[model samples]
Target chain A: MDPTDRETACFEAGVKFGALYHQFAGTPVSAKNADSLETAIEESIENQPGCSAVSVDIHTDKLETTRGYTELTGEYMDVTLRIEYADCIVHAEMEMEDGYPLMRVVDIVEE
Target chain B: MDPTDRETACFEAGVKFGALYHQFAGTPVSAKNADSLETAIEESIENQPGCSAVSVDIHTDKLETTRGYTELTGEYMDVTLRIEYADCIVHAEMEMEDGYPLMRVVDIVEE
Candidate 1:
């Protein structure tokens, strides 16, 4: 079936998120760079087709470091995003998988 | 930021797909029930708020069976969906992970 413009835009946003996740997956997470990584994530989502605003909360306050790599066995980031075509909110969580970011939807509810 | 209605709907669809994947995961795959599973997936996506039509193609023609559980080492399903908000197309692929379906975006392009 053919997708509507809004659906297309939403999916595009997800694609962008996936790309960004891969981009920052293996990077070291530390207080010195957490803010920058979060900003990059927020900007990537906001730059999508329908996204106007995005809130990213990276859980880097307690990252365990071994050598030079951040141990992400139980770390996650929360993402709250707003798009331009619907009246609901999108809440998602990005978790570490094989030391890479894997984004999944937590919920979508009316605002 | 608040998500638009379309974004919410799209995320909802993904959630549904994930649930359905879990439901059908570990089930034996064969010609006997491939059609039914595909239908269930399509219906699940189409029932979402913005989705109108969905195409689901399960790759069960060459499934390898061991005991009763289907070995999904290299099996995948393709889903093409349409929603009522954008002029683009959403194409995704679902692969088996630990005998369950894991969906990922392939692309979103103008149709």
Candidate 2:
């Protein structure tokens, strides 16, 4: 069977979450540049189709400064995505879960 | 409604593609480092849940050399992912599609 609108919306939401997390995960980030990274992530994901808004919070406070800068990963950030598709809108988020970056749908509204 | 096994598999594949693309994009890349980046990309995404295999190809020839190294993007690479979930397996691919990295499910089989 073909995918329904709801499922497509969910898939699109998942795409945004994955895209947001991976695209910037390995960037060299230090406390001084965390703000810029956050803004870049938000703008990057917002460029995706169906993505209305993106909010990224990088936990620079948790970053290890021993190396001056470290590769970014889920352990140092949280993200939320708002995706609208067809007649449905989706809210999704990502954060560390058992050391893995877990992306999940928070809610979906059909309107 | 709950997503079926097939839908979940597709979603997983999409996640890997997004993660693979985003996590490595913007990295400093030149002919000298493209092979290593390809290996790193394949290994990184293979760690994702339900992802069985990943193949990444970075086109060193297409890279702009004005700065000696260019950032990676859809225009510079192609990727394929294999994901398995609840007895269903999915094959997905990503490449430059009209100026965007278009990812789509290529096939899904149940076993």
Candidate 3:
């Protein structure tokens, strides 16, 4: 069967989530620059097609700053994305679920 | 509607590709560090579930070395991944398609 608009929307959402998490995972981040990193991540992913909005929160307190900077990972941040494809709008999120980063679709609205 | 095993395999393949592209897209790279980054990327993505193997090649000749290091991008790398889910096996690739990075499913085999 051909993929529906809703399915494509979900796939696009998954793409964004995977991209957001992996692309910045090993970045060198620290407490002092967490703010800038968060903003940069949001702006960067927003450049993708179908992505209407992106929000990133990096937990500075959880950052491993022992070396002044540590590699960023899913454990230190949470992300939400709003993706619109055709008439289907999808909401997706990446959060730590059971001590692991999980990307999931939260909702879908058709317009 | 529920997604089939093949659809889920495709979705998982997309996740790995997106994660691979985004996670390392903006890292500082040069001729010397390209090898290490490529290795790191392959090992990192292979750690994910369903990813059987990953191969990455960094085109060091394209490295913009005026600053001694340039941010990595899809333009600088070509990646191929093998993903195994349930009884389905997926082969996927990310390469330059008309000056833009294109992620695609190359083939699928079931056993």
Name the candidate that leads on lDDT.
3
Model 1, range A1-111, lDDT digits (tens) per residue? 444444544544454444444444456676567788788868865765556777777776556655544732225565555545455444455556686545544454454
Using Cα atoms with residue i matched to residue i, what is each candidate's TM-score against the true structure? Answer: 0.41, 0.74, 0.70
Worst 10 residues of 3 chain A by lDDT: A1-10
- For B1-111, candidate 3 gives per-residue lDDT tens digits of 345566566667778888888778889999988999999999999998999999999999988999999999999889999889899887888899999987767777779
Give the Cα lDDT of each candidate: 0.55, 0.81, 0.83
Of candidate 1 chain A, the 10-residue stretch with the lowest lDDT total is: A65-74
DockQ (Cα-based) per candidate?
Answer: 0.07, 0.35, 0.30
In TM-score terms, candidate 3 sits at 0.70
Q: Rank candidates, TM-score, best first.
A: 2, 3, 1
Please name the candidate that would achieve the greatest DockQ relative to the true structure. Answer: 2
Residue A99 displacement in candidate 1 (angstroms): 12
lDDT of 2 by residue, A17-39 (tens): 77777667678999999999999
Regions of candidate 2 where Cα sits further than 4 Å from its true position: A1-5, A24-44, A56-73, A108-111, B66-69
